[model samples]
Target chain A: MHEYSLVEALIGRVEAEARRRQALAVHGLSIRVGELAGVDPELLRTAYETFRAGTVCERAELRLTTRAAAWVCPSCDAPIERGAPLRCPACEVPARLVEGSDALILDAIDLEVP
Target chain B: MCTTCGCGDTELVPVELHEKILAGNDRTARHNREHFLEAGVLAVNLMGSPGAGKTAVLEATARAAASKGWRLGAVSADLATDHDAVRLERAGIPSRAITTGQACHLDAELVHRALHDLPWRQTDVFFIENVGNLVCPAIYDLGQAANVVVLSVTEGEDKPLKYPVMFKAAELVLISKADLVPHLDVDVAAIEDALARVMPRPERIVVSARTGEGLDRWVAWLERRRLELGLVGRIAGLAGHVHPPGARGDRPAG
Candidate 1:
């Protein structure tokens, strides 16, 4: 899956940032995954464990936060429930998805510096 | 104790990055979009399951576009062979193939590299036939003006509902192999109903690549899309655009 590739990118980013701060080691990593992002959190965790053996994140705690999918009605500005029809309940128009999908943000990282 | 500086205690700091995991790929996709726009080419990303006749549709579209004096180019992706690219070239279009050894989907970086290998300047309509995968391809954007998903009559009508992510991301859906409808138990209406349930007002075209059944309508839709993307002078002298066949009714291939 593409999770491995994303993990590798995460490693690279974390390493670059750690080096910039003259950090000795990494302690933890916080990541946010959206429901509609098409990424499985379990798979991502497995990838992180497998690929973090020799990287700066070798001993870092991986904290993953998954967000739910939400849709906002374009016509009536109402929040539609997840798994509901894409149409707005108020105005009966197609709602726009404001958030809860397509997010893969690396929220924060803990680094051990001298 | 700090191992690096012989300090009494280690100082831990929290860094806020707040960056996307696929930021690199998205940046490259954005650049590719600018490049395509600058070249005045209409790039269409064609995606679907394997054996869904993605290549066949490309071939038919290539031939039809050629007769109208329009230039078309394609970049096909597969895990192992260059067969699809060869087939497109045989159809008289400038084509190239990207062989992604272990990867299941085509990313923007690979397509960017493939763009350099083709004569994109002379191309009016460019097509990227992604690796025949319905799942992974929907997650990656190849900087195309449109994402078209192909589904054949042989596949069950519940495909759209089963693979909602792919169907939802697609701008257009092509129900290929319409010629085999009468010989099979597939229900076209059921497929349309499924698509409607998953997607909001999805645009669809039913075609049979074997007999050139809906080539005119398909080409007319493509022409309109290209013109909308500001490819005015490039497609000006091409064959007059045919009006898109009206209504959602399916026509049995003759």
Candidate 2:
């Protein structure tokens, strides 16, 4: 159910672009969901099917790429790997989360030009 | 050279969107920020779990700030009901109860509409109290000048560690309901320690509305941070349009 809401956001964006281009249909969509984005890819795919029915994105193939969270410590300036409870492994300080945690751009949509 | 053209292996061309999906939402958030600026309003986003005394805190803020001649307005978000808004208005500030209607988080678009219709010009400060959620609300920016993470002293110290993102992202950490601290086993030191693990040790204020403790410091903090809210709104209006993909055609013929 949580994933459904994110899926709705993704679908809504694609539909907006689709309308703008006067696209016949969305053939496929590519998205990169960050590991720390707090979204489940499988659940997103499932929810996508439900919301896409009778929509412009109907029959669109959803391609997802999961990115791991990356952090850089402020004091020591070392990269840290993703962990459940995030912290700097080197300095043990709270790592300044640099990137790979954002719920970012739903990459691109493959459209059938009208 | 295009791969299909096969002109040469030395030349490479890449087609990428390089655009954020949340960009649209961010743009709307920027708009909301500008609206707050022109109106000279301070929007503080209050986030925490359900029953974390978010509404209670707003009530206290309204009452405390009112004496200082700071006109306050609050927008309380929930899945349903304006109960929190109703109670907040009784504090003598005009409050709006927002029913998200199946939406888990309050997005920027919704806040934009709320601001447009809100009495932004009349209020000196505006508080957008998010739905009682620690996780989802962290992702959706409500265009607040500062994000305040409210934790009841009764919720235990490890709360900051458990919900690290919310605590870490907050500009301020408020330990609410200090009245219950005497009876509870809440280790204030441990909470402070946990907070240091996730974020730079932020200004921590402990307050109990009933006891009237730490209210002055809280009000002072609001006064200090008031200008930042106006800046938030102004920046949003300045960034009015986004350049489309490949729209920046100007080049020096490199």
Best by TM-score: 1
User: Taking chain A of candidate 2, what TM-score results?
Assistant: 0.80
Report lDDT (CA) for all predictions: 0.84, 0.73
Q: Following a full C-alpha superposition, what root-mean-square deviation does model 2 have from the true structure? A: 8.0
Candidate 2: tens digits of C-alpha lDDT, residues A1-114? 466767777778888877876666778888887755656678878888888888777888888888766667788887764433346666766666766665565767887662
After superposition, candidate 2 runs with Cα above 4 Å error: A19-23, A74-76, A80-95, B1-15, B227-254
Best by lDDT: 1
DockQ for every model, please: 0.56, 0.22
Residue pairs that clash (backbone atoms under 3 angstroms), model 2 = A105-B20, A105-B21, B33-B233, B34-B233
The 10-residue segment of model 2 chain A with minimum total lDDT is A80-89
Best by DockQ: 1
